[model samples]
Target: MASTDMRDGLKCSICLSTSTDPVMLRCGHNFCRVCIDRVLDTQDESGVYSCPDCREQFQERPALMRNLALRKIMENFRHTKPHQKVIFCTYCVDSPVPAVRSCLHCEASLCEKHLRAHSKSPEHVLSDPSTSMEKRKCSVHKKILEYYCTEDAACICVSCSLAGEHQGHRVEMLDKVSEKKKEKLRNIFQKLTTKREKTKEKVRSLEERWRKAQETAAKEAERVTALCTDIRRRVDDLEKKVLSEISRQEKEESQSLSALIHQLEIKKDELSRKMRQIEELCNMTDPLTVLQEPDTGDLCDPEEEEGDKDTRGHVKPLHDGDDLDVAVISETLSTLCDVITGIRRGIYVAGSSEILMDVNTAANNVHVADNLKTAIWTRKNENRPETTKRFMCNQVMSRRGFTSGRHYWDVEGSRSGEWMVGMCYSRIDKRGRQSYIGYNHKSWSLWRYNNQYSVIHDSEVIQLPDKISSDRVRIHLDYEAGQLSFYELCDPIRHLHTFTSTFTEPLYAAIYVYESCATIFEDWLCNWP
Candidate 1:
């Protein structure tokens, strides 16, 4: 039996109570296994683990062996009479062992098994395993006090539930709060996922637009470059022609100068010889005999004045001669250059026009249906007077007018009467105007002047009453007779009207009436006598 002193009776670093299941670490320090496990479970901000007694660091999952002898001794002591007093659960007192270890702040006790289960449960309020024993606290309330009020953020002892503040508030076991928070977090994540998808769609749309714009810009750049290259090619051709023309002119001038020099030398030699002959003749003493002899030397003189005039007219000064031709050449070159410049300008203008036209056509070609689908349009009742009168007429005619054939009525009958059939027709009339005609068992009418009024008969004009319902009246037009007729029933004898119009283009008429008013129109159409 070792003496039970501070060294021998080492307390658990986690519970700060004497270690019952003592485990000796490699460093010779002893602690309850559960105590060290709790400490290891709690992670600090920096995540380092330290022993409480020696303040020494130990790796997670320390190489420790349990002191089985010490554990047995503690177990024996626990069984002693003084230590054997029953520890009953504060809540549900009938149970000897608690189901869970309530937080100290909440003042609940739990059995060993319950305590172990609760420690791992999300709803449990296990103390931070990384903290020192003295600093350990309930996870939910963070209170060192060994009691909890199950209601509303309150820390209380078992007797505190009856207090006024917590009297009505729903009290739940503190351990369940963690599970609730986790569930709430999951819901938040789900919502965030939906938002993320929407954001991704928007980003995708923007990226698509960016890609399209980039492609368009690239195409435009290519077109501009091609135009520039064509211009450069034309310029190069012009430059080459101009250089060739300059070289040809230089060669021609050199040949012309050589020919002129050769002709001048021959003229000079002839003039010198002729002068000598004239001098010899003058020196002769017997001039009459020399002239008469006509023998040895030539007696003719050179035409100096004529030759000098010809040479002066034919030969040009070197510097001045090229000036006129060069001026003409330069003017022609300048005109060609101007033409090329104009061509370049025109190309640019044409390209610009093409771009503008494309944009304009795209703008004009927008789909009407697509625009309308997203827009709300207002509909006004323009034929209120006619509509009211027609409705009344239809009701009366459908019930009283002659009926023929298998005519069906929709109103005042359910699967027992005939069904009403109707249609509407519209077309251009003779006066270059559009007309609408409606026909039914009750009556027939024409909408002329752009539906402003109804044409009832050929001889008489009648304005539709304001209270008449348009749905009650129907009209039919006969193109062969150039007449429009109305009927109250299928019988021809119940004719309502017959009107003629000076319409040239084919006219369309809409024949429609309420089922209640179909009897008269049906009888008229059936020619019932």
Candidate 2:
């Protein structure tokens, strides 16, 4: 059987019972595995995890170290023997006297009679009968622990705070420390309650968005399917029309060739008849008869009639298949492509308001004007005061960021050196090469340099065709769909490039200027002229 003192030693502070699946923290305190896990879970949102006993904060969740010795001792305790858990008066050496209270200062348990006879001084603090009186006293000084050392995050006696290892450390009475801890816990509780409500609202919003997305996707799919069906039907009709034209040409050419063959056959028959007549005449016995044959101008005519010659010359040849492919099929396909492009352009409506630049993030050489819609690069630095939010490079970000929905903005640039227009996360770097728009993973941009256009993201560059170069460019962003597209603003907007990526943060409009000026247009679509 285990003694009362041994039982107390093996107890868990959380359960006030023998530890089950005992685990030790780095601070040397032991708790049941289940109990500590619950405590840590509650601290997750607080951003500061701490030990339950000492309140020592940890930068991250602490690892649970199993106390194998304690586990074995508990197992042995369960198997050894069963006995009543009762404490006896320390002064009763003759007969068994049950302890009613324990004096932490004296480190002794007492019966009712003995407790009444004991000192009533405050130093002789009495608590419910506890076998582990040593736990409430300082080990080094053998004095009752009455204060909490803020520096050490441990309980200490007055002597320890004054002259012992914890000398000169800030300390507070245990009761006052407990009250402060309760107040902090109450604040955390309030914050948690608010966060819970907000999370619920977020859940509802997300559900609505999910349903809306599904409906939109279904409608779009149906429309696309219908469009494809119509395109196929139109193409089939064109095929039939082209084939019918080819068949008509073939039939006409065949009739002309057949008529010419018939004329040749008739000529052969006529020649045969004339030959027989000549043979019969040669066989004639009298020369007078042969001479009597009238001297005709011609025996058989070899030339075709005027009408027949005209008919032969007018006969048309078969049409070339290549011509059908080029004239009919090519035009049809071109028309289809135009229709599709028009649909693509019409699907997204631009309702984005005027975008304004954030002057706070502008570099020393960059200037914002025209109500924060224009950015110009000055050759000379303005020597502006330094701030962490200010960019050290020739870059500036917009004041507002886009978190959802589609947005577009048009920018007109000067035909000068280099410049860029794009979107970036608000957390983009403010200094060094990484801060350059289009140079880091946090940003994506369309860059114009040396009369060449290109798109860049995460140091990856894609050169666009020179034909897309225009004074004005449009940047379209579908935040929810994770699509960013660039277009050359012309009579018919030409698509330049598209970047697809999953975004985890809000996107802000960003610009980089070098010996150039960029002006963002208010009412981008209306200002097309």
Candidate 3:
């Protein structure tokens, strides 16, 4: 036991093993001769050297001369167990084996056989057997790190704290500082987990809204498809009725013309037979008999003259009933019109009021409904007496016009082959073609000519893409804001165009139906009182 203690006391502080060529400084600190020499050489570049242990300053240099006595003492303990600090290799690619010694400089455990092939320089820094010696020394100061600089958050050695860059820095024990940093990292991890959960919750909410939107769109599509089907069926039935009435008139006219044709054919046959008899008589060689044959005119019966006189340019006119037998037609149209209103009211219950046609403002070619909400364009003039407010052109305005507040209404649009519907000033031209919506500056509107579309303002046309018209068109007018927006009212409304301008006059909902009806519904009128 005493021998072990004595040998351990003789170990070099630099390598923590039996020292080779041991030396003592003026401060009485001991190190291997090579170790002290290297340390002093680094400090000499700055014209300063100090004892590694006590940090005592040197003015010029330190002697590198070996201590024979200390060396002899270390030699005595070299073969003892206290000198058993050599490391064996931990093979990274092959089997594990003992290391000859750990290199403090490289921080790698070397194999026993590798020691002979290694560099012969003392700077290679062989130490006590250890694979975990990497953290034992401060990298920059090249000394055992004895403290942690809390302010700088770094591990530092005694040399660094006393004479190096961290000389005046606040420091603490390494273990205590590590614990505080670990707690901080744990708190950060917990917060990140909470944030992840919040993101997942938001995703779930968004998914639910998306699903509901899809469902609503599907239901609206189904409703519209069914309504259109019924509409087409009723229209087909009406077409058949009108055709059937025309067919009955055609049959009656055909019979009357046939009787006139038969009477003329009989008259032609009688005239042909009598003329042939007269020719035979004149061909007789007996001239006396030919001259005395009671005059070929006397051979003609008096009744024949009467028959020829009566038959000249004779034609009986056929009766073509001008009036259609519309018993079922009138009832069918009434029912269909009622169904249209029902569909409108059921489809829209918010955001707009039902609109109606204005009779006083309707043109001669328009038939305004008594309900005043529908107008069908007749190809011929209705010939009603002209009123002061009646339009002379193919256009009409609503009874109500907006000077303030927001207004929205939908028109049951016509596939009318040609039509234009939009907002116009109440005082817009009502006398000529210029009085038509979009034909003047007072109107801001979309026009559908055939299947194509365009926007018109100040009589200038902006061509738009062609699209099959939607079943309905919604007009959104912000009176105070001076905005006129049009949308194709589908399952979900799609904006087609917008007009932004300052209004100078009250704007009316003006419509033009060229060859069919365009209906607008007000909510109050559509609803039951």
lDDT of candidate model 3 versus the reference: 0.74
Q: What is the lDDT of residue 9 in candidate 1?
A: 65
Q: Each candidate's lDDT (Cα)?
A: 0.44, 0.83, 0.74
Q: How many backbone overlaps does candidate 1 show? A: 65
- Give the per-residue lDDT of model 2 (tens digit) for 236-314: 8767766676676667667766886787689789878878888888899999999899773446444533443445565
Give the C-alpha miss distance for residue 339 in model 3, angstroms.
Answer: 7.6
Ranking by lDDT: 2, 3, 1
TM-score of 3: 0.35
Best-fitting candidate, scored by lDDT:
2
Q: Give me the candidate number with maximum TM-score.
A: 2
When summed lDDT is taken over every stretch of 10 residues in candidate 3, the lowest stretch is 313-322
Model 2: lDDT to the true structure:
0.83
Q: Candidate 1: where is the Cα deviation over 4 Å? A: 1-191, 275-324, 335-529
Q: Would you estimate the TM-scores of all the predictions?
A: 0.33, 0.42, 0.35
lDDT score, residue 343, model 2? 46
| Model 3: CA > 4 A from native | 1-136, 144-146, 239-245, 263-529
Clashes of each: 65, 0, 15
